[model samples]
Target: MTDPVLRLEALRHGYPTPQGRLPVLDGVDLSLSGGETMALTGESGAGKSTLLHLAAGLDTAESGVIEVCGADMAGRDDAGRAALRRAHIGVVFQQFNLVPSLRVGDNIAFQARLAGREDPGWTAELADRLGLSPLLSRWPEELSGGQQQRAAVGRALAARPALLLADEPTGNLDEASADAVMELMLELTRTAGCALLMATHSAALAARLGRRAQLRGGRLCDETGAAA
Candidate 1:
């Protein structure tokens, strides 16, 4: 494969507990090419979210290296990592972390503005594609769950970041709405040429992606149950 947009090597992370450090991820390694969509599936507490955090620079690993677009995160400070995330990464969570005070349009444009690349044309296109154009002025509280999720997705993709991380993005939606939102997300991500690492529990959803991996025993493995 070509050089990966995001790569992790021997990643290990854990939290403090009474019994010493409770390891979450253990020696995890992954590589994602640009415009590739990979689904991560596992049971609850399988370290899916933790791995996403490490990939997106939201959290640090205990050991090993994480590289985004060829920049190693191991030696970077908090501000540096944050800057990297702002420049080349976008994340969408299950909770649809939209700012209640900002309108839908503003929320979608927020990260782009922070990145100092707020292109009006791109933002408008995202709004229209995500079906948020009619409700651009509405607040998060005024929308349905599906609408809120769509807005969150639009916000993440509007900046055209090199990497997009999504955690249980369709967990709260009904089957029909989930299918529609997933289709839109796939289309938008492909159009933007963003590498997508999505953590989901649905096998059906995982099957739809270009590649599927599972998080088990504190590591990521391929679809045929072999280590990747």
Candidate 2:
């Protein structure tokens, strides 16, 4: 059997507030397998983004373990964690956070180059598949919203990471554009055999994935929890 690409064990995180430490994640546990996609849904202040941040190694958990691609996050220092993310994780943000200074093609190839795994052919193919071929030399600020989002997706995938973490990746797009980006993301993740965990507020978007999970009271629960 294939090992899970992501595993969270008894994770807990919180922030210090004037009142006290307001807990965000508590005893949360999850496992996601290769090439499988899971949707994370919840209302505002439910800690969806907090969970994604911890999984991506952008933040440290106050307690518990986070394992990605078999390596325990708890065992790694700051630089080690960064290296881990660079080598194995791809992230898409809600804001379409592309480098305005870099051209479309360069942005797509950036992470791959950092990982020392750049493949010019694959990068070009991704640009073509994403319909960004013509915009290769254009800067991100010159593109439309949909175009910018597509480029973000391409940039994330170019690294061919083992796991992909997306936070409301299509939230800024119109219905039609959102649907197209979601479909393309799934298609490419399947082709790369990458595991996906996307946090979205849209039920329709969550329904498209293989399984659904929810964050409530700082806990991670299955679809059944969505009812509670």
Candidate 3:
């Protein structure tokens, strides 16, 4: 069988406080294969975001293992981690982190360019599929919230990453816009055969994924009954 695209085993992490270290994630385990989607759900301060960040190599775990595309994330240095993220991972957040200075076309192509695998045809196809072809010439600030989020999705998928990590990607949009963006995101992830792990509070959104996992008291509970 092919190896899982992402795997976490006995993962633990915490933050320093005046009292001591405040635990966030404790012994969380998960595995995701290509074209699979899992929703990470929990309440405020439940460590959902922390898990995503650790998985993306944006932050280090205090203990246990985080493997991306069969590579141990803890084994890589800062530069190596950055290289790994650029090569195999894509990230999106509630705040659309588009480069304001660049036009929409350039913004969508940003990550692919950084990865040194920019394909104009693929980028153009993504823009068209995202319904941003008309706005490609415009700046991010000029587009509506939905339009901007669509562009963000396009940007994340521009490089055809092995894994995609999204944190409350539609939190800023209205219900209609959020649904539209979610549909496109789901469709595109399947089309690209990328593994997606999204942290979201909305049950409606979580229900759309292939699997669901809840974060509670620093541990993970698989709602799908596969594992935890």
Find the 10 residues in a row with the least total lDDT in model 3: 219-228
Which prediction has more favorable TM-score, 1 or 3?
1
> What is the C-alpha local distance difference test score of each model?
0.88, 0.88, 0.88
- Pick out the ten consecutive residues of candidate 2 with the lowest summed lDDT: 219-228
Tell me each candidate's TM-score: 0.94, 0.94, 0.92
Question: Model 3, range 91-205, lDDT digits (tens) per residue?
Answer: 9877788999999999999999999989999999878876788899999999988788878888988888999999998887788767877886787678878899999989999
Report the lDDT tens digits of candidate 2 across residue range 1-228: 766899998899999999999999888888998899999998899999889989999898899989999888767889999999998999998778788889999999988999999999989988887788999999898999888988888888888899999999988778987887788779866888889999999999999999898898888777777422
Over 4 Å off, model 1: none
Candidate 2 clashes between residue pairs 3 or more apart in a chain or in different chains: none
Task: For residue 27, give model 3's deviation from the true position in Å.
Answer: 0.7
Query: Considering summed lDDT, which 10 consecutive residues are worst modelled in model 1?
Result: 184-193
lDDT of 2 at 56: 91
